[model samples]
Target: MNLLSLLRGEAFKRGIHPPQNKLTAERSIRRLPFASRLVVPLSQHIGKPARAVVRVGQEVVRGELIAEADGWLSVPHHAPATGFVEAIELRPSAKGPWEQSIVIKVQPGSTQEVQVAHPRDMGVLNPQEIIAAVQQTGMVGLGGAAFPSHAKMSVPKDAKVHTLVVNGCECEPYLTCDHRVMVEHADDLIEGIRHAMRATGAVRTVIGIEDNKMSAVEAIQAALMARHIPADQIAVQAVPTKYPQGAEKMLIMALFGVEVPSGGLPLAYGMVVLNVGTLAALGCLLPRGEGLVERVVTVTGPAVQRPGDYRVPIGTPMKFLLDYAGAPAESYQVILGGPMMGQAAASLDVPVTKGMSGLLVMRGADFCDRDDQKIYPCIKCGECVAACPMGLNPSLLGMLAAMRDYEPMGSQYHLGDCFECGSCSFVCPSSIPLVQQFRVAKQVLRERAVA
Candidate 1:
């Protein structure tokens, strides 16, 4: 039942691959000039919104906490650039709606000067103290989960986490932000993993990457070796190159040969997986005792003139980033993550946050060519069934969704478990938009529940 034993056996399973289109994998990350104004949404993560501390016209320095964590499940927000507060009100965010936000105007020619972070030895701190210190830094999953990092660290005392699985499997095509982070900031990642081990009391750690990125695997392996961390204590294993392999459950199954029971957390399998980027951010924040005000982001696609990864400050606008990346003015669609699972932006003014790992700009020519975006009936060819890693009948669900028979789909067919990986749509020859139908179905059910 122990997870370590599972890794010794067969690892991860199936998912479809889209074009990697990774135009910036080899490019070094650069820092963009602070936008003239930042619209930092208070609720960037999945939990409670942080409370704003600074008022309008108040001056704030880089890394200064502008909003304090409102609860254990939230993270604080800091000034990414030295600036004066312009307003604290509802603003457009990347999530497709306006949320309460703090806006700032960068002081003319502001330079990067981080506020003095009060640091201390990790050995001197207790587990709770370490958790408190982590909360102070405003860290989140950074891999797009955007769950508060402190909340993740606070596992129930009754549930013991044995293996801290570091997911280096950036399997989503076109998203090399995690890959670049691992290659460039391996030291920080190692240090952060250690902090995570301490936080969770895990006896061992393993960094799992898909085979496509041998360079990242080599880099992390070398970092571990130099640190004198034994091979068995901290490892670097190459998982198969499969889409959704980066999905926490799929990665666990692949790297450790352990299946996370349907709808179960890895803790049930005695494992806790953290993104490589999460560890890297922790490595930077834990020692300095600062907040997560900025993060590394990938801005790439055919529509972009300058396609590469850049360190974007939290609260920068989507429009600014697209322009900064030299995106074509006539681009057709802009996605906030990878094509398979990324959300479409409703407006260009929405600001970036901890959860946005990739921004993809696709022109009309880049996507599948279609006149009128036609929808064809599924021929029941069983392709989707074979393609589904979870082995669900997506054709039936797609039909149900189209017919507005959502209740039967939920009650009789188990619709809630779909994570919307877009696998079925990828395999469907008719291009029935199976994933799109599922999205609408889930949304309708969710809204009905709330209503």
Candidate 2:
């Protein structure tokens, strides 16, 4: 069946369809010039922070390893530009915490060319070697998770992986970095899929794109055909364009008609899902033996004058990017990713880390209008229940959160299954921040558990 027909036939229930403000979807990615200073944080990934290897006053080239992985779960960090190490000090992070960072001052007139290490022939490498090489590239899920790519690619020996699901669904509004990657870097994405399949011992790979991006599906299909990839080995499938379709569980359901068990991963279903942009980075970096120094980021919103997809260095500050994007001088809110899931930037000085996929700048009026909306008591409305993709009772959970009854929310209501997609909050007539309350409850539960 054609992709359009396939999308019509299959869709997960209970997902809100937000306006896809993909203004930069067709804009080819342009490289942003090196910022005068870069603050490379060691804890960009999910696990232990990397150990700094370069000292203050040391000169480092772009793509040069500046920090080493402290453990198997951690990934190394590389210099995003050729520069002198000015200091290793604490800097503001996107998460509103001061993190240890390596500050680099760009050298005058230095051509910021990446110094590639010896390239490896991926064909000769065993699965273990492939995983190691992926780790060395300092890659993480570029889809805002920042989970280490190598760790994700590594499947346990007992489990068997049958399918490699490549996620090209840029479901978030105002974020087209992944869409642009799928369109412009199709070959690299395909190559990355092959490597990921081999690493995980998957028999076949499927690229699940949203129907809205038929152009991406076409590009990927052409790349697969040009490479003569066998039909059964790889195929592109288009799912419905819905909010949170980019989530691994939802995408898996849409494509394969299977639901990932609650509190389990796609791995439990004999599949491994990867983001297209993440794979594209691995495809490009692994062959060249270069560390991940840059990524394509969408810079757009009401306050941006030059909204487009930009290839920005890892440590580039949000302020510098806003300036490059011609952001308005007046007050504006900067979000590190898409509106629904992305966090508001604590400060403009926060550097763009691996997890950041888009930079959304909204005018003060636009931001405050939403913030000023009053929250009312839940009217026992079933809108949140109807909107929840996981089929969890968000209304009950919200009520539990209100009474500080988090344990029942988790134990009885199956609160762990909620992915915080904000669909309930979006559709709520009371304007209650249901997702926010859920997040706070979850965090409190985690803290209590740890204590």
Candidate 3:
């Protein structure tokens, strides 16, 4: 980065600052007890579903590969516990659909330790080898997108990556898993950054943390000092605390003062951004030669009794997690992530996937009186326009969405640029579900294209 970039503070325009209800920010991550039956979804990521390799009734050890990647776009699945495969059939997903899943009944004395036969020397692995190792780990973006990590590292042959932008900005309200990872797993995170740098062939890395996480910044700085890496190679920079500041484009702009071209990727501009949690986990897992079978999830919200960060094994049922967290049996809505951009869970039967960062449970009364409950007509207010970080007219897009003019929303209005961060909906005085409309419109457009 140039002197001008350094002088330009990490500030992005037009983002709403909702209450930072980060209940577990100070809480250390504790491991949850294994649920009786774990439901491993084959399609836990954004790509093709994994092909199951284990038969029903087969015994599997923890971290053992249970499924193989179906194609280049897919990721494999690992057993989250030492258990017997109970069944392989359709199971309820948080998205309101039944998906092919492997049901594992936990063994009587299943241990938390993974069965690793050998540890690999990461120092000897080349870039391609590192990427292949990432694929073997079945790693994905733990930042909730769940895009395969290996795929991100597999930059195009023509692209030349200069910097590996590390996203430590846990800007979403009530989600502190990434924050805790940065603070508690600093060594692993630095190691992960090194792996990412090697994989992406980037000479330097910049960790853009939100100002709210000063402790995380300090922790990363200490780690870097202990590692003896030059500041030019990797440095931690604090960005302003703002909603949607954690978005890739927003963080990129905040750090480098460069806006990714509309409908283009950061890779196009010689950068590869990876989430702190994803890299930390990769750093820890790659050496062990283990697959991603567990992750740290923030179980918090107004409705949770034992609110804190919990190291949860993947495929643990929502009901089991909630029960462990002392959630009420009465009617309460569960959002699988933060309140801003997270979606409401369709059912409690959904098993925790690689994408889940936090489980936010709230009673209906929590939002009963909020303006969002009752939809109102757009008042032609420019609140959304001012709040949108992408500089798109959300009011116009919302109007277009209501009219089902989806094509123009993309073609003329640049709907594809909107990352759906929910700032527009938060600031809309009329309580219009502008973000929800955009989501539906985008989904409809995808379906239309397929048709």
Please give the CA lDDT of all the candidate structures: 0.83, 0.88, 0.90
Q: Is candidate 1 or candidate 3 better by TM-score?
A: 3
Candidate 2 wrongly placed segments (more than 4 Å): 1-9, 364-372
lDDT of 2 by residue, 183-217 (tens): 99999998898899999998888888999999999
lDDT of 1: 0.83
Name the candidate that leads on lDDT.
3
Best by TM-score: 3
How many pairs of residues in model 1 come into backbone collision? Answer: 5
Give residue 350's error in model 1 in angstroms.
1.9
Error of 1 at 67 (Å): 0.6
Report the C-alpha displacement of residue 148, candidate 3, in angstroms: 0.5
